[model samples]
Target: MDTTVNGEPRVLATDAAVALIDEIRRDYPDILFHQSGGCCDGSSPMCYPTDDFIVGDHDVKLGEISGVPVYISASQFEAWKHTQLIIDVVAGRGGMFSLDNGREKRFLTRSRMFGGGEACAIPGVQKVV
Candidate 1:
């Protein structure tokens, strides 16, 4: 699946991330991908089951990046509503999809803006293998 980012087209379905998402979907059809407010350094990416996984304000195709529907926080969904976003599936030692753009800034795991670190933790989301 390709989406525009920074006015350029980017592929969101990476081989590794897509495979992982497919496996997880077998158990949990509804999942969410978000970054924890802050962690050791800054914000960290999070993937897990969500009890309140609303579409927010984003109108992204749920099946584009596999059957697992993608949803963002209401605030985040609104923030990037105007900007084109590509959900690139990724996997590595660190985490999942990495938000790449000219602006390079680490996302804190326990960001105060994201409702602190305590609220960032997911119930069943495991690290991508």
Candidate 2:
């Protein structure tokens, strides 16, 4: 289902992802997600304890899922701002450093471009100059 930040829809998470988040929460009460823009993890969504990772100044808070804040880098956001991010759980290993690594299920990011009306409804979207 769609998750919003301050009532503005931004991201979505599958039921399996929500269940995994719930399970992860049992250990790390304060957790968050960051959409990796390739490199070691190859664009997977990484989950971490809130205290473990430092959110950069340029990071954008997309939304929250299961009460956990989700973020993406400003550069990544610029490239993906026109789309809605959907977080899904798939059978595999998570990012090496992510909390979900040992669970054998990784968080994947899937997205779809926002429709005209939907684009207008999202906050922070700007017209190309």
Give the clashing residue pairs of candidate 2, or none: none
Per-residue error (Å), model 2, residue 62: 0.4
TM-score of each model, paired residue for residue: 0.39, 0.83
Q: How accurate is candidate 1 locally (lDDT)?
A: 0.39
How many residue pairs clash per model?
Answer: 17, 0
In angstroms, the error of model 1 at 59 is 11
Clashes of 2: 0
Give the alpha carbon lDDT tens digit for every residue of 1-129 in model 1: 234333232113344455565665676667665533344423444455655444445344322345444444445545544432233332223333432211132222211122122321323222221
**TM-score of model number 2:** 0.83
Predicted structure 1, TM vs. truth: 0.39
Per-residue lDDT over 5-59 for candidate 2, one digit per residue giving the tens place of the 0 to 100 score: 3344678777788889999999999999999998999998999999999999999
Candidate lDDT (C-alpha), each: 0.39, 0.79
